[model samples]
Target: MTAGLLPAPEDRSADQGVRVSRSHHAARKVEVTSPKGTRTWSASALTDHGLPSAARRAYEGAAEAMAATDPSCQLPWTLLAGVGRVESDHGRYGGSVLGENGVSHPLIIGVALNGAGPVAAIRDTDNGRLDRDTVWDRAVGPMQFIPSTWAGAARDGDGDGVESPNDIDDAALAAAAYLCSGSGSVLSESAMSAAIYRYNASDEYVALVMAMEEGYRTGVFIMPVSVTAEPSPDRAGNKGRPGRGHQNDGRKPGSGATSSTKPHGTPGGKPNQDDPSGPPPSGGGGNDDGGTPTPEPKPPKKPPKKPPAPATEKKVGTLAPCGATWCLDGWTLDLGGEATLAKAAAHDYNHNEVAGETNQQELDGLSGAKVSVVVSFGTATVLEIEGLPYP
Candidate 1:
């Protein structure tokens, strides 16, 4: 197994029957996705006490991307979704969203970050490029990333070349990656606490996020009942599409995430740091663990000039936005012929251990195989093996 940044333990708060801070108000049109396709439902029919549909889609999308991009992080999609809810309400904290392509408009910037409150005092690290502040830096985006934190971990999940903190696609992916920085499973109670602490450092914040996640698992937070409806990019994504095709998104290996300040809990095995998340860390609260280093995100290299669907080692569809983790998504693997891997589970799967070319050997005789156990870092413990065709 790839060394975990920190083995995250299962959140104990799951047993708490935790509740979310936000009460659900039925939105007129709530979008949903499933085997049949995309659809929408009435907000008044019933409501889940959690994030809105769009926000939930972003979180689920990030979870899918991270299964390949940051396998070390074992936290479920709900955890990241909860963070987005508490941080900036999934980039809509103040009526902001992906207006064009996948960029969050009306930009989501935090306060001046003066350290007067529970937040730590963090000076400007990006020279006003990200936060637009020449002095104190603030957390930006739906997931609430400070400039420095975004620099190192930021990923262009939309393959837009630019790693904008405001984009929920990139921001959620980066946030999930940041949490996987330590060397333990985040499932254990200890590791779970540590992981949440890394994100915020506040016990209360952890509890709140934990509660929200529990609600999501139960019917408290629900996926819009799969129904027939119009797809709305206005909600979670462009009908489940990741990004706006291939843009030069100028990222480089070890770029994006600028410095080495750990965004979450320190690499140390401690507990209850009392750091509040959101905005910038004032040296105490928020992403101030300054823990260990995670695998640096590699920028997308221009693909070799070739025919469309470049075949051998070429990125296509959902795999295009993924940078260094492209191989993990089975993009380069020759699934014999015209086909791609479809995720068995829509919301639950490991993002890190995605199938790669190396594993192609296992599927060599798949033509005659009735059943096969093909696994790459999705969920390690649960092996939902079955014969699946490459899309």
Candidate 2:
């Protein structure tokens, strides 16, 4: 749904009104922008809390690496932990465990995304190499990365000489990088919501993840004296600091997968079983460490202002292919670049009839046909088709 459309029904465990309570000591509030308005987030000091030994190390290591490479991102370990908890319970989903080497013991895989039911239909991109399904794709590992996305964002977090999505170290780093993409930093509330939305493409999912993340930040736990210490000389020297010098762990896992169907690392349909209705036990919901005392997060710098957008314009284009859920929901026009037909226009088209057929039916049949579009803010509510079955 766009800005003004009725909100999609909340998913299991993802109430549209979900909010993380902030009673815990040392909590800090950060405003987050969502489709439902502004929501406050409480972030707190670093704590080992309830995280597993290997998993905690990987989370911290990934944050530290990102800090070194992209300091502006201010990527938090807690954020990565939130995704892990929601996606696969920190590699413990389905009785699987994060082994000493940081790889999932039994491997956590989701159902095939065959475009069946509420699931998005995505043709197999990896040919049974990563998800073990040649016909369709499935979310895999603690972070649940899809094969195509993993191919681009995969990292060697543990410096183990191989990059596998099943490894928490690699998965966590890849997820951090994925969330940190685009122009703005994730520290801002709007940017944070945008980043998470890019991950799952659902407002409910964003609220749920933020709530769980806030839980970890404020929950009672042993606070580390220093959460942002400079990388230790030993750690800085070895890219495998978290791996404990284990280069060849002998774990050669397949490429990872995602539960959802959107391309470019969007995992839409994966069920978050960590806490169906609430936050997990403290640190379990989030994990990342800082060696120095955790300092207060600085406010994000505002971007330079821009002029207001123009009212409207007309362009010629063909319809974009209906591959993902977003495409199926609205009309996508390919006028050199993909643009969506406004929801209001879509509703009108669906109701009108053309040659005894509903406009939606006709529009679907006319996919890829040339047409002229009247657009504003990259969305159009008016169209002039070159060819139509009816006048």
Candidate 3:
């Protein structure tokens, strides 16, 4: 497995469990895991991370509106959290670097501090001084709204005259609006999921959003359902054939009734014991006709049995760098030679020991290097070269 790429264990607490404040409705805690330990916070952490108060308010307001739009909209809110985490680390912006020309840019910085440089800054409009757009142009606000798309979707969700991308509330509201768009409804599992994918096009984004939404619903979200009745097949056919009655008796012999039996009061009623045409019923003993009892059905013949599944080899021990380990069922190998030999031993069934000794000798002769070897219950071979130059 690659280092630092594995997901953190889910049981860890978030950010030392520090709880941040939020609006009454927005007051929910989030747990995050970090090297320092797990820490917990509220929506207020967005502000502490350098998001302006106005932006935070906008995000909260948008969430409320989305909750009202559809309970499923919460799915988008969870996605919003992940978007914010990845794009701007919860709204801590302005960490860009400058290019050789001495202007800041929006490119990603290296892990080491000494290796970092200033990124180019962006211009909001056509000012023409170096001509770059504002850093916000790259990705701005709580969910990192890109300027080109934000311009069309951004609204005065809080009724402010100027709509700024850096504002959390504005960004969140824009995200919700984009997700609730026509195609979004069909795309999302719920209204919220649609909005999340609209914010960022990735399955990871969807998973993160779903996780956060699960947290939110447990706190204060509620969903409602609606129902409608559709026309039945009979009703639909009746619409096409205007005068068709429920019972159509106009038909030739063998078409309408034939030899089929009907219940006592049906249109073509039969003369069964329940009908008036039969003899008067005897007192609870049997039918007045005195019929004999029918015998039970015979059992069905059994089918042939199927064969059992093949058995698998049991692993007794592992082959290591020093030498092979002993096992009743198989053999092992040391790491001085090719990995292919070990792989072959693990899989091969006929050899009952290492089977690639000859192949390893031949490989060593050709490459002028030592070949690796592995012996086991099987005869599969794996090969690799040692002391080779880099390409």
Best by lDDT: 2
Model 3, C-alpha of 353: deviation from truth (Å): 90
TM-score on alpha carbons, each prediction: 0.45, 0.47, 0.31
Error of 1 at 9 (Å): 32
Candidate 1, 248-360: lDDT as tens digits:
11222221111111222111111211111112212322334674445444454432221121111111112222332222222232232323333233221222344533322
lDDT by residue (tens digit), candidate 2, 98-175? 798888889866666665434556678889788899997777678877776566556778887788888899899888
Clashes of 2: 14
Model 1 scores a C-alpha lDDT of 0.44
lDDT of 3 by residue, 1-391 (tens): 0001112222212332323222332322232221111223333432232223343354567767766643342424444444444344434434443232211245321111111112122334322111134321234444544444454456545556656555555566666555544221322444344344434432223333443343332332211010012233554444333322111112221121111111211011111111111122333434457664343444432312211111211111112222332111122222234443334232222223445544333332333222222222122221211212100
Ranking by TM-score: 2, 1, 3
Specify the highest-TM-score model's number.
2
How would you order the candidates by lDDT, starting with the best? 2, 1, 3
Better of 1 and 2 by TM-score: 2
Q: Where is model 2 more than 4 Å wrong at Cα? A: 1-49, 220-391
